[model samples]
Target: MRSTSQRSVVIIGGGISGLASAALLARDGYDVDLVEARDGFGGRAGRWERDGFRFDTGPSWYLMPEVFDHFFHLLGTSAAEQLDLERLIPGYRIFFEGHADPLDISASATENMERFEAVEAGAGHRLERYLDSAQRTYDIAVERFLYTSFDSARPFLSAEVVRRGPRLMQLLLEPLESFVARRFHDPRLRQILGYPAVFLGSSPGRTPSLYHLMSSLDLTGGVQYPHGGFAALIDAMVDLARAAGARLHAGTAATRIVTAPGGPGRARATARGVQVRDPAGEERTLDADVVVATADLHHVETTMLPRPLQTYPESWWRRRTSSPGGVLVMLGIRGELPQLPHHTLLFTRDWSANFGAIADGRVPSPASTYVCKPSATDSSVAPPGHENLFLLVPAPADPALGHGGEDGAGSSAVERIADEAIEQLGRWAGVGDLSDRVVVRRTVGPADFRDDLGAWRGGILGPAHTLRQSAFFRAGNASRRVDSLYYAGSSTIPGIGLPMCLISAEVLLKRLRGDHSPSRLPTPMSPSPSHRPPPEGTIRS
Candidate 1:
């Protein structure tokens, strides 16, 4: 192990990945400093409050409780002790366009199977068998893939990987839609099994079957919600990082990554420090032995580093597929929404057409949308008589789509889309006169993501998880052109989602420590029902 004497590191972006990295490295004896451009440290998972209504700006669904538990355990504490989580039974309600009533997806595996049996004969048993296979795939991937940094192929050529070679190959070759289609005849069941891919910013037909582990994570593993909101988890992480001896700077934006002077003989540049602008617009340079960038991968490579020292070029990013951006509407309503559940999905009947429009760089006329009413579960988000509603509609990330007003009338463009989205939500999900009931309203589109978080192409989830952009094929965590520069975030290996961010941080930590042993996969554990919500006024945005 390297000596802890006077070693210092600088981390850019205070997202989940950056916070996790800073905390872990500090605990391991490195002096760490994290800088965030935003007023707060959550990045995409930031929070906002207006007129007594609190909203979690991003990532409402909390999946993979085990990942959170394991991360906290690594820090010598437990997630349960830091924050309270409630398993969302009947996790979400799904509404098909032509169907009369919605289908409720239960948290219990047995209940889910029974619901499947109700839909079609023997499908329940088939689902049971499918989840069994999915569980095994999840186990293998968590053990051999998700936690390791893919610097080379030698680690993957181990005896364990060779033994599971055939199964792995099969998973890699098949598409998620094809895999689900082969098993279930019911379109709704197939849709349920395949829709999880959308969360990864992929079409079911384009995503690899290796991602079917999500089904196991949803159906068997379960979906959870933090008591205060998703932002509560961010608070927990920030508290943990600060407690571990890392200094966090909010409202400080990194301008560029500085490097040692280069000459003809120096083939590789060495990272030295970072130049940053503080909240008051004052600029300064902070020196460090190593730098970790958890910001947008494209922004870091193209804008932060010098042209000659940059590893990935603009042309390379242009060739890669980026995930779709979204149009979000946050409405604080006057009264309760009796028809809507805590989580609801309104899927268009023409799923193919919807995906085609997004892929072809146009917003679909009638879009499938997701709605979250957190007040249904926890009333603290809003006043006693009101409800907090958040609606998300997926759209193409093309800048020309007028999301951020490239045409000079950006606010009007956003208003037009918001009008359509509200009408659709009212018509499909039974929210009557949604526009008139709205007391507080805020809209966020592709331009918001680009301006606020510096997301590449205004994409929310980073690069699309195409086969070529996943696992070992994704961007390496360590920089090839700069020796002491590294990356950790949704754009790097192991892919997106909150769990992946945590895993990305761990992977970077192991690489920095030169410890390549496989991470012990934590067995999936059910959240205890005994936990209670945090006391009022405990967690702040």
Candidate 2:
């Protein structure tokens, strides 16, 4: 048995949240170690460079700059020190068919509303009131709600949540369509207000209004990007973690978890260590004082731990409203897209029918698609006279829709769905010659997300943020059944998005350190020489 004096921690998964946790822990002076299944860090924020064209294939948008700033500031540094951040002028653009001009959403809400009023009449005032309510929701959510682990709504079961909660409720119970209808008479204006929620991968009618929090992040905090692309932010955090004394192991996958006794019950089982498979198919074991899983909770529950270590039954997960998965096309256009901005959102006329298909377990037809042209702000991303484009469409984790079906990515049905998406995007972008101008093209769908991101059924943001599943009602940050086992990332509390991921990491760190304790953790400079994965058999390759 390992001695208690050998205090060390092992983190499974090296995504933004995992890396953040490692940075905080190591900086606090604890003996920390991180393991990743991939060859590099950043996870979903990982990037790929080919032929001098850099693409941040995942998480193309950066809404809340303050989150990154706070992360670095906590570490006695600033994100600006390691990354060059560019603030986008027109935050994003919205393209609708037959409209003489596209609307540009910028940091100046008054100006944006004035432009909307000019097109739709009286839209400016209505937008003012609408944003006022959204601002309240954002204030309360960030200040009071987002920081804690919400395993239950008991904490919010008060008059405050009852009153302000309805503000959240107005966003939650009412479909965004109804919310917009109440505010605007113009179809175009309504479409603009309702369109952003498409990122949730559900129609405004099905998706709750509360998700309007997205707008607050953009309009209030503003959108910013790292000069090198989103990947630079991840690399910055990784550097901070390493500097703080955290040990990272890349291309290492955790296969099994060993737990303490409870006679096959979750409450008594504490995570002790893990079995890892390396690139060469060799397996090794390592023990630790604590285990934090930034991996998908469903994956960890079903695949890594014994059945007894699971917090909730598989039936619960199967019945939950899993969020939408998607297909992302990364392209290096040979020529510049003069009309496109840093970010552009293209809306399909029928979003309700589109999301309805997904909710009913069908691939969306004529779905809304988002296009991002990062090179508009960061010149270094593309070679001279070129543009980097990323197009994303919300689909489903359903196996039926893999890569147009013939190539056999996963499901033939999913493939067909992807093919349809490719076709539709070509039409919407008005790029009739997309197949010709494309210098480089790569596609990623639900299947790739499932395999690479460890997403459960490729649900990118875990369970949907429905009224029943949101807030403290979402999964707890700390596993109730497992001892010394904690969770961080989009799957756990604070829900999805880069900002929330960082907050979740901070919450986990707080829980690990103590109950609101302010003292720094003592650093163990030299780990015991004998403490190593057994030298006997080969580790998983």
Candidate 3:
């Protein structure tokens, strides 16, 4: 067993994955230093505040409680201890086109089953059968696959996996849309079951049926909100990382990934450190035993490192498919929106056409949208008389689409989309004066995503988890051409979402320690700072 006490790790990017990696490594006796170009943490999960209204700018839904629990458990704590969580009674509500009434999905499975039965006579049984398979697959994924880096097949060769191999393979090969369509006669049910694929940064028709496990998280376990917006969650995460002795540097950008030669004939390069520019625009070197790049993988590989040291370079990125970009409209309304739940999804009747529009690089006219009224749950987010709303409208990941503006002040494409979405939400949700009630308005579009987060193709999420891009086919955590350099985040192995980001960090840890066990890492005894700090000497360019 090698001692990690003397080793230093430099993490580029202070997103969820980067922060998680810091917490893990810092607790494991490695001196960890994390740097973020942004002024604060959370990356896409960041927040915005104005006019006494605070909005969680990204990732509203708090699903997959088990993943959250496991990640916190690894840190010798629990999600219950770190977060003040309140589960929504009716997980979420869905509004269909031309349907005056909305369909409410409850936290109870039996109640949800009855809700499905009301829609279609035989749909309840079908949903039960569907959920049974989904739950089993979900269990299997959490236990066997999510934590494994897929560096090899060793982690998945268990006896249980072998017995379930055929069914699992069938799921991986089939499309989620087809699977849902075959079981439910109603399009609403189909939309309800299939919409989860979008959370994986993929369309139902393109994503594998194996991802149907997403339903088990929200539809069954129910959806929750962490009392104060996601910003509070970010604060907790920063606290955890800091408590574990990891140092986070905000407004610090990594200019280059410094590499040293290694292997026979110096064939491969070893990561020696990172070159960074501080908020003051001063350059320095962070000499490290390991470099974990948790930024957009494409950005780190294509721009930060030299061509010779790159594994997945510009050409490889050109062939990869990114998830949809999104336009986020944040509104502060002068009263309660009682009609809308904590989470509401408006699904267009012609789902395929809506997806097709995005595929064709055009915004859907009557786009399917998701709305989150956090004020319904947390009063602290908005002023006493106002409510805060966050809406996500998926669009083509094209930066040329333009950026967001305050109060729809700019005559840009982003504001146009925001205006249309306002009208769309008003009509569908039966709120005639929705636009009139807006006290404050802001929009975040594809170009905003690109400029703010370095999103690949302005994507809000990472790559799509399609058949050819899921599981083992997904890019691994480590660089093939760079020793001791690792990747973690939505763009890398294990896929998207906040839970998946935590799992991605665990995968990075596993790869570093040569641990192939699929079980979660046990909590360490009294997690103390186990290493000395790295030198602070600045390196001139």
Candidate 4:
């Protein structure tokens, strides 16, 4: 292991990934500095308070508790002890049309199968086999693939990847709709099984079969929620980072990365530090041994880095649709709603036509809706005797489609869309005029996400999780152009969600610590003049 003195590091963007990196490195005895652009530190997955209602602005669901537990454990702490992680019983409910009862997904496979059987005759045994296949894929993937860094295809080109190639192909080749179609005959049952892929921003028919892994994560790991609010977990992580001796510069935006040639002979351009302009526009320079970017990959690649160090060209970005943007609604109801669970998915009857409209830049027909009733589980989120509800509807990230960008008039149009969506959800879910009962509410559109999070095209999760860009095929965790620059977040491997962001931090830390060398320092990237004499006399070897 490298000595502590050689490990001073700077992490850009105070997202979960950056904070995790800071906490882990500092705990390992490396001095760390964390910089964020916003007024707070949670990035897109942060929280906001308004009019007596608490809202987790991004990522309403926490699917994997172990990922958070493992991260905190690495820093000599336990998430269970620090944060009240409650296993959500029945986990979540799914609403499909023409069905007498909605399906409740339980933690146990046997119970879930029983529910499946109730929906479709003899589907329980078939679902068991389907889940068996999904679990196999999850076991192999979670163990060896998802946690790894793919600097190049070299790692995947190994004998193991070669041997496992067929299995991987088998996992993804059939397409989700086809696989689910073959398994169960009920339309509602198929929609329920295929609904998880919507989180990937792709329709079941278009999504790769490997997306079955999404179900596996939820089925195997179990869905959970923090006792207080999702923000509690963020607070705990920030505390852990601070305790590890990392200095956090909150409400600071990094304007640019200053750089110079790395090594003695001017071979590579190393990142010297960043030029930051705080919320007040006060400028400062933060120099460090390395720079970890946890911001949007496209933003960092195209705008932050100097032109020379740009690895991917604009054309490359143009070719990739990675993540789709959406409209999110936070609602505070004046009265309690009956029979609503902690989570619910109200899918439109015509799911295919809805995606087609989104693909064509028209308003999605029968738009899929996801609802979260935090008050169902924790009533403290709202005032006494009130309900706190959050709703999400996926839409195209680009503003040209009436999504609130390119034109300043987008928010108004988005509000209209939110109004329509709220009405539709109420009618479909039998919630009884939800829009009329709202005492407090807030609407977040694609443009709002872009303005707040600096998301490219208002994309929430990085790049679409398609087979072509999945796993090692996504953006590498390490920078191709800058020797000491790296990336960790949804845009990088293992890709998207809270758990993946934490795992990205682990991958980056391993690389930074493993590649240390004295000669790697003091390259041309230093801001001081090259003619300046070396500090002190060189005595000991």
Candidate 5:
């Protein structure tokens, strides 16, 4: 591998952020190596295959096309060339608990507006206004907030932001639930707009209205999927990282963060490298000039680093709010499910009780759930005659709730949730004989996230996006205690979701290069090392 720069970097975790960071640094001439505990890469964007059936076991939604595009551009590639992308029309279907027909939300702004009009008298026009405000804030955020190190208050206190300070502050202070409820009287309409806060790992009641920026994604930007599942995207990222001269070690668990010698305290001490336990259980060390940890921040802080060297200690985390964990059920069915779309949401009418139960650490009976039927768009996910279904039920961040298993092989509590979800789908979504059609089944609970991913509180996403945990208030990218030790992932700044993870890596690049500008990168470093794939449609957050 080329090592002309002499400066070497060791990245922990092989997730999106970790891999992206590795690819960017390696392309910049740093000798880089990344290690992951899991046997494969992609972290939460994992994949599973069986009997010619494949599943994107982790993230299903490909939101924020610009972030993905820019990230690939930085790596001397373009998303259009690196992978085949499909923009999902009528992006998703929403099925109410008692409604006979489902509401389809599409990429076309006019089509979605008409659907909104049909739901409520003036909601269509109101939605237009809502999205306008959301887009404005989103643009501002993309420019001034998402790509920064937060090294100073200048980004937030800029003349542009200060001019809009009162309005932005009002949005920040109000809860999302209140914001949506006031504008849209129809519960379905409100739920449609507010549900995104759930994926960000918090209920609308707790998340700030500023997150209305999320509306601009599906409502305006639409949803996207990469053919061959997310695994194909992961494969491309791995390929790029490898081409850029980065070494990847799977099944290698990093046990500790080694630091410079002769340091009496963590302050001002440089990171030496990472101490890891390999597949054979043999311990070894990988030396580095700098270390970037893109794993779950809680795991790296509480488990990988020694007491004094940890920037966020156990006590610090105790006081912070983490996002909700989830119950994930994957099923392979025996026949076509034309009644279902690629993306669907089953929202209960009484979401106040539904989401409240989750926030209070209880399972919402008839809980609001997200269902992904990727087979509608990708033929690679299942056998020719069969369909694939993945279910997500928002649950409390408690691992003791139980683990998942094939069929009902795991915890009774966890299985019960999965069982109820199946029945709910059959009842609300009219998917008759749903249970009988399941030829393959697997359920993942909070414990699996903890055991498999080292997720804090077994959270599916990292920290919750509460007003207190938003933006600069969130955990930083660099270690405040240890020099040369940095972090990039869902748990760190820029917050949750796949797009945020990509931006987090760019933020890390800025931090390392001592370029703290929050604006978009002026230009790609070099010509792309890829052939462009023809577009199926324009693409996401």
Candidate 6:
């Protein structure tokens, strides 16, 4: 057994959560090494470049800027000093199928209210009231729940939860769609309020109303973008981990988790290290006192560890609702798209039908697509006369629904879906012959997620944030079946999103430091209501 001073840590995966965990552990005097299966460190936030165009492969939206700031600040600097962030004006545009004009959601409350008034009478004031209630929900959730590791029910018994008990019950018990419908008369308004639920990988009707806090983050908190691309943020995280004395190894896949010998007399099995394979197909064993898995929880438990050491079995995972996967198309276009904003959403006429198709393990044709034209905000991503575009369509994560057979035929199916998505996007944006302008194109699908990132069921977002699968009900940061083993990332506590990943690292660090009560962790600053929009013209449908 190694002494506490000589203890070393091994982290699996080089995503934001893994990097953050390595940095914090290294700073705490533990010798740390992080292994990533992919050639890059960003995981889903990976990047690609070709023909002078850079595309952020995943996570284009930058919400909850303060969470990033707090994480960087813990490493002895500020996010502002490490990265250049620009706030997007009129945050995004939502285009309905038959509506002549798209609804623009502005950062400023006054502007958004005016737009709402144009649709339904007295809707502007109603939005304000709803947002106010949402703000309260946001505050309570952030301060009391988000940063904590709910190892027990003690935290929920706090005075704050008691005082806000009624409100919490209302939010948790109601469905997001029902909540929005009760508050807004117009379908557009309801869609605007309910659309954010997609971020949690569930339809509004299935998602809990407690997630309405996302609306506050989107409307009042404002959207932000890293200067170059999401890749820059990944670079910052890598630099921070390196500076903190953590060694990072890309292109190395962890094949097995080595554990201490267990028998009838042994109390529990302990994580000893990891067996890994390099890019050259060379396998090696790296010993460590502790192992932290920041990869997919299901993959780690089922593949890396022995079956008997698994805390969650295949049956357990099968019952949990996996989040939906996405068909992502990255295109480097030869010309500009004037109709597309920095972020644009084309919603179908029947949102229910779209949701139903996805639930039934099928891709929705004429899908509700999200288009990100980064060149509209950051010119550095593309060549002088070109535009960088990313299109994402929410689809089922079932391997059976994928185009080809699970093993090798899925790529072809992915391409067909991408082509169909491009056609749909062109029709919505009124840009005929979109394929002619595409000089470069790449497509990623469910099988890509499963093969590349080891995502369970090719789910891009991990487990869905259903009432039964959130907080304490979700996977724990520390493994119960093995000693000296911990977990982080979207699959664990604090749930999905980049902000939650950062918070998950914080939770893990607190547990390691013997601070079992994570409610004591410092709260990140929330956005104020004073974020006014810069002067920019709105793009209508």
lDDT of 2 at 191: 80
Q: Each candidate's TM vs. the true structure?
A: 0.93, 0.88, 0.96, 0.89, 0.95, 0.92
Off by over 4 Å in 5: 1-5, 261-268, 526-541
Tens-digit lDDT track for model 4 on 245-339? Answer: 67898888888877778777553788877888877889988876778888888888888876668876566788876466677777788887875
* Native-to-model Cα distance after best TM-score fit, residue 464 in candidate 3, in Å: 0.8
RMSD (Å) of each candidate, 1 decimal: 6.4, 5.2, 2.9, 6.4, 5.6, 8.5
lDDT of 5 by residue, 333-387 (tens): 9999888989999989998898778878999898889999999999888999999
lDDT of candidate 3 at residue 35, scale 0 to 100: 95
C-alpha local distance difference test of each model = 0.83, 0.73, 0.88, 0.74, 0.88, 0.84
For residue 295, what is the lDDT in candidate 2?
A: 84
What is the clash count for each candidate, in the order shown?
0, 26, 0, 4, 4, 0
Residues 282-382 of candidate 6 have per-residue lDDT tens digits of 99988888899999999999998877788877988988998988888888888878888899998888999999998888888878989999999999999
Query: Clashes in model 1: which pairs?
Result: none
Model 6 CA lDDT for position 517: 68
Candidate 4: segments with Cα more than 4 A from true spot: 1-4, 152-163, 263-267, 400-410, 515-541
lDDT of 2 at 36: 93
lDDT of model 6 at position 58: 85
How high a TM-score does candidate 4 get?
A: 0.89
Query: Which runs of model 2 end up more than 4 angstroms from their true locations?
Result: 1-6, 98-100, 151-172, 200-202, 262-266, 403-430, 516-541
Better of 2 and 5 by lDDT: 5
The residue-by-residue lDDT of candidate 3 on 192-273, one tens digit each, is 9999889988899999999998888777788999998888778888999998778899999988999988879653999999
